[model samples]
Target: MTDPQIERKLIEIMRIINESDRPVGARIIADELRNRGYNLGERAVRYHLRILDERGFTEKHGYTGRSITLKGKEELEEALIGDRLDFVITRIEDLIYRTDYDPVKKQGNVIVNVSYVDKDDFEKTAGLMRSAIDYSISPRVGIFEEDSEDIFVPTGKVGIATVCSITFDGILLRHGIPVKPNFGGILSVENNEPVVFKDLISYRGTSIDPIKIFLMRQSTSVTGLLQSGFGTILANMRSIPQSAVENASLLFQQLHESDIGGLLAMDNESGNVLGAPVDVGMSGIVVSVGVNALAVVEEYGIDVTTRPVSTIMDYGTMKPL
Candidate 1:
């Protein structure tokens, strides 16, 4: 295993290479090291570079220079957990929100306006939305934006309420309100259409009860909560906040030992409320069932949209009605 000192040095090298606009040579790297007081000789730096290249953390070009690879980027991120993660978490938290109102009904509609080439091209759009939510809501979520023309750039704040549009199969559509161009670039175009509207609308058509949807959404919110909590905890870890570290470490341990298919509640101050423990064979089943149940509730809403009478009858039969 690499010692922490060496690992730290390797991470530093990766960070330096990654931040560079052009590939960097070992000599330049050595100079940088000396400037930073690392005092590493050219040979030592070259050795470290070779080690990094061999480990696939970096790549070397023909007789020119070296650059950090994806693995190197990840390694640098993990190593800088004490510095970057907290900033990332704070940025994400500053962007998202949770509200009691319905999205579809709202005037602004928390619109997730999509402008894909085609509606059937759901994968990329969905992926973008999911990624946006994950990054905006969770600290564990990695920064995925790359410096590519094909990649979507988040022009505004990254959390919830901050809106942007994505390209459909080929078309670019905007979500929420559009903004004027600032120093960076022009904001996405505004669309009068609501992407998703939310409000407490009455539903007389189903038997599942409106409260059920609310309950299910709240339950689903648990995942978001955990995600946000994880990010917050991670940020705190990077800052070496004592209380955050202890709490996050304890939570991480519980999560690792948690049943694969089970639920872990954080509302309670206790470590966990695993439906199935890690040692239990049904852990996956427990987790899947919970996720599936939440999905079903989300998709169908509190009331069965299609089988309203049947659902009502079933509910009536189950109760004293």
Candidate 2:
């Protein structure tokens, strides 16, 4: 097998190339890595670049710069999955075993976000979500569609689903919220609504290996949303008012500076940006794990001082997604 050190560097190289609008050179990428605490130089970076090119994860432009290929993006995402495995796995445990679940008054939820390049990929992901949801045996789950009001979603686009876990479906860590019972959904303001994974799936579909999904909500007990799922995690910023959410520089900055290693920081492209400054108004509805949640709350000045869970809605006959 390739040296683990070199393999990591290769992933970082692809990350830089994927985030850059312009072609990137090894020296530029190497320097970037050094700033992030990776110890390497241009020569070493270039040596690996050639290997990546040979592996078809990237392409070279002689003196111009390097660019990532479709394969490269997939590899990067897969690597990210590895990086988040511990956090995800841990949260999954926390949700299932660490918390109390009441069927009559279920108030937990998990939001699933999926990124796809084509119709075929979209369908497979949707089917996977369906299978995962069924697997979870969540009592109630609402797959959010495009909001009729233009304010919540684009006029013409695939509506995203905000799968709510009202019944302690799973456990997740909200970055800025306290580590108690809490609620909030993190989503993009511009995008407004989730991109529904199922609708985009044309009937001629295949299957995808299961992926862990998580969600957070602002209210401690979201009356109707319910859940049941595979290994997953969640985070929420419910206390941050709608006003402060607009100027999320510090919220995202705090996230970047946070030591908790929550959700992956998003990059400038589509879907998730793990370990970078998340976009402003990138909203999520997550319940706090109560551990790392306080660090963000104090820094951002959110007022969810206590877990305000009360008034469980009578969950009567809600269909599952």
TM-scores of all models? Answer: 0.27, 0.29
Candidate 2 local lDDT, 34-151, one digit each (tens): 4333546678888888998998999988789988888988888887465443333233333333233222233323332211123323344344434333212232322223342211
Tens digits of per-residue lDDT for model 1, 169-206:
00101212111110101011113111111223122233
The positional error of residue 293 in candidate 2, measured at the CA in angstroms, is 22
The candidate 2 region of ten consecutive residues with least summed lDDT is 198-207
- Which one wins on TM-score? 2
Q: List clash counts for every candidate, in order.
A: 30, 50
What's the distance in Å from true for residue 321, model 1? 95
- Model 2 clash tally? 50
